[model samples]
Target: MTNPKISLILSAYNEEKFIKKAIESVINQTLKDIEIIIVNDGSTDDTLNIINSYGNSDSRIKVINQENIGLGASRNKGMKIASGEYITFLDGDDWFATDAFEISYKEAKSKNTDITMYQMINYDDESGRVYENDWFNLNNLDESFDNIVFSPEKTKNFLFDLSVSSCQKIYRNSFLKSINASFPEGIYFEDMPFFFHVYLKAKRISIIRKHLYYRRKHDASITHVVDANYLDTVEAGCELMRRFIDNGFYEDYKFDLIAYKINGPRMALMDIREDAKKPLFKLIKEDYEKIKKTKYYQDYLDNLGPKKKKFFLDILKYDNYTEFKKNNPEY
Candidate 1:
């Protein structure tokens, strides 16, 4: 199908159980003019077999198999071979709303958007509690507008608040290729850097004021796991900030970048193992030391109150998470 309306890139690893649900969600969509590209990233389970079965039955489904190269690389492969006007990624463990395509694509085409953003629902498997994330709410403009569209530069204040997950946004294929936009390889926090790449290149952005994606949160999810790979958070933050500086956008978004770097990793750090606390804390302080050398660090650092500033400094003294948790008030 030449120039399919949308290309859905599905990346799967060992997600046999969830992959079926994810694929069905796409198949069940109201918009059927789409090509589903499923990348079976070296699945050591029945994932590949399941993917192949679907491809055999559906002429629109395309399957690619390769050794485990991580999520970012897998998505990059799909994007390379994509033959669609618009592209969006769907994790093997996640699903899209029935009208995600019809709704988002219509607005994207009408606005000529380089990037189309939408809200997401976080599904917690253990407790069966599902909640909507307002990161893509666009509340400030909702009262005056329905489908908000503009250059991200015009609303720089919303830059940091934008959703970093690829599943929450759709991109114009030609626009992404023109800017050479792709996910960062060899890192666990690839989403952060890739989102920054879009943030840097996107000019005309539009939004769907509805939840169009469902992200599963469970013990098996990578975000909930803690290991050496967790160290990639610091590196991802640095890469994102470095890109902003390289593109000459850092000075304008310095404070937000710095604050996100320090705070963004905190949620994952809270689940760090006892053995990794000291080493991880050491790196965190070292990361701050690197931040201090930046030209705008002092400008923003000075703006912080004495107590808030002390909290940053105080974190350096502790070698253990417990000691820090007991005495230090800062996260």
Candidate 2:
């Protein structure tokens, strides 16, 4: 009846093709003191049967069957049901390196940190080519953050640079509940706001330089999809802005917020559906217009290089997708 060292929450919605390997990865972890909580988010395929089969065979595996909620809500359900020292997430479409828990748990225990961040291995389904997730790339970072446990306030410089993906970090169970950390339900970028809220409040955060998880980027996953759901990014941005202002961290991370506001939508623009551009652009415009009146607006823009400066200029110029295409054409 002793609690496990880690609770690995697997969220799935018709991910039958990859669920088996995902389950096996946890069942075969180098660290055996772990509990596997599988949340079947109303999967119409054989996902439920496969999950039940694994649950029946393994005493440590716990399965929850529910109507389709969302990635955020499913994780919330798992967090409440989990009884472990620490909690981490694994998408049913992804698998972990066998030693993932062994390494991260050791770090979390030794450092006594609220959260331990690590790297992810992104593999293409068709090409079978593997590459490190860019979030942990040192060249992109201003400093080395390996094997260190530090407070969030002292390390505010790299706040926005970190990935919001929940799977990249292992969180102490009590610490997470203390802050009431929960992802925003029914949204695509649910992790964005949740990450900022808890990270800003965390007393201790640790970083690991090695790739500990494997993330599959197949066509069915959200990353490759081009649809209306991309509009959820706008709502996520708005929610994070509110959290920043209300939580008293707005002044400290104003530029970081601005930078993400400008760059985040631009990055998504390249992949969002053609018809979805105008509304997204309008929301971006409204957000940026308020930024224009701020005294530090020029200071933030002055620091940007030539290409980014031009990109912002184009963004500020047009409120409509047709006008943007007429002027820039290149995008």
Candidate 3:
């Protein structure tokens, strides 16, 4: 009945296939003083039934069912009701290493930090192979982000680049609540903005280099499937950049970071259907125009070097890149 030390929030939507394994991973955690709150986001499949079975068996498991809200909204809902000192997220389709909670909890407590981030093992569902060793390790910097400044001169450089996935991190509930930080509702790239906001605000953060979170790469996941929702995520990234500019942090460093963020979604847009391409391109063009007006525009253009600069120039010459792709065939 007492508040738990950690809360594992799972935002599920039609994830019946992997819910059991995800739950079992938490149940088998080496750390025991934890509660698992499963937010069943109006899953039409057996996801809720599977979660109910676990709730019946384990006193630590709790379930909340609501109409279909996106992942961000579900997480926000869970955070509002979470009764733990520390919190972490687990997607329904992904499973955690058995010691994830044990390792992160102890490290956060010992270090007395606002956040503790662990590395991840990305699993390829098709080949049944492990692609990489550790995904979140950056080359330079300490485990904590206590002294990272957001000013133009300081922000332009890669002070920190390894904050990748949301599930790979454990956060102090008090810090999260103090910043009034929750995943932004109704967005596709929910993790990036949320992670950026938290990392920028953190007085202290810890990074565990060992790979503990297992991310299952499936075709059905939003990251794999391209859609209008995905374009919305790209727009959200632009919005974040605009926020940085509004706060007087726009510089060559910040612009490069925004460009880097935009680049992934742009590549993903290539794999989307032909019909979705035009509107997405228009949105990207609008974002690009906004970037061009910033003081860092020339620096961003110069820093793009040869390859990306050529691509951007080509897109500008053609009005859009899809037309060029159509003409070139080999592109």
Candidate 4:
């Protein structure tokens, strides 16, 4: 048989409650010529059994049962074995809009882009409501530029503005393979670095305004549960900035990288307990102080947007929340 047009990799760990819905959503996609590779990462729940039930009935659905590795490793396993022209990822707890793959596949083909990105709606399970991710809305180009194909250099600023969620876009399988892209095996925030790697390696990327992905907002999700592992985001962001410098693309991407560095600690504080906030912020602040001494630091700050510059400067000045907030009222 011919390989499928797109390969959808779904990674899950003990997500029995939402696994069925997520699987069914894949089956209902408007794009039929696709393969679904589900990696059940040591799910203690009935997630493996549920995946088996579907895999038994559908030829397109393939399931991999493994010991509880992290999400990045599971996704890597799925991608290594994926047999499709294009590749995309899905969280086992989040479902996509019906035509997501169809639309993204067509766009990638027609525009000849290495990646095709679209917007996502954040679904609130408790409220049973869906809303556009405010971050995504900020990256939307004016109507005149809707459905535009942009070079990575052209969209450097927007890379920071747009959602870096892996599931928000579809990538050419060859493009990913050519770059030998893989997630950080045991990390919580692997997507951040992985996302940046893709953009940096790709020549062209296309963006459309359509909301193709639905990201469920629930406390139990990995992102919502704050712990030491949550610091992975800070580590990921720093590593991403370091990569830009090593590749000599730091100047072009410095503003966005600085923006990421500042916002990461702020967002981390929101989910973390009060007791952990101060220490975490202090670590971030000290790290930034060291980064500030680098030659590229001034260049990054010089290119930063006015508001972003103020927030970053404020973060550098104050480690405590009260002082930070007092000085940066606009936040």
TM-score of each: 0.88, 0.88, 0.83, 0.84
The superposed Cα distance between candidate 3 and the true structure at residue 77, in angstroms, equals 1.1
Could you give me the TM-score of model 1 versus the true structure? 0.88
Compose the digit string of candidate 1's lDDT tens values, residues 1-331. Answer: 3689899999999999899989999988899999899999999999999999899999999999999999989999999999889999999988999999999889899999998888888888889898865664545445444556777676677677766888888899999899788888878889888888786788888777788888888778887778767877877887887787777877778767766776655644665665665676777777776666767568547554565465456565665557777785443
Question: What TM-score does candidate 2 reach?
Answer: 0.88
Return the candidate ranking by lDDT, descending: 2, 4, 1, 3
**Predictions in order: lDDT:** 0.80, 0.84, 0.75, 0.81
lDDT of 3 by residue, 37-92 (tens): 99999999999999998899999988999999899899999899888989999999
Instruction: Report backbone clashes per prediction.
Output: 0, 0, 1, 0
Model 4 residue 235 CA deviation in Å: 0.9
Is candidate 1 or 4 superior in lDDT?
4
lDDT of 2 by residue, 136-175 (tens): 4322434555667778775687778778788989999999
Cα RMSD (angstroms) for every candidate in the order listed: 2.8, 3.1, 4.0, 3.5
What value of lDDT does candidate 4 attain over all alpha carbons? 0.81
Q: Residue 88 CA error for candidate 1 (Å)?
A: 0.3
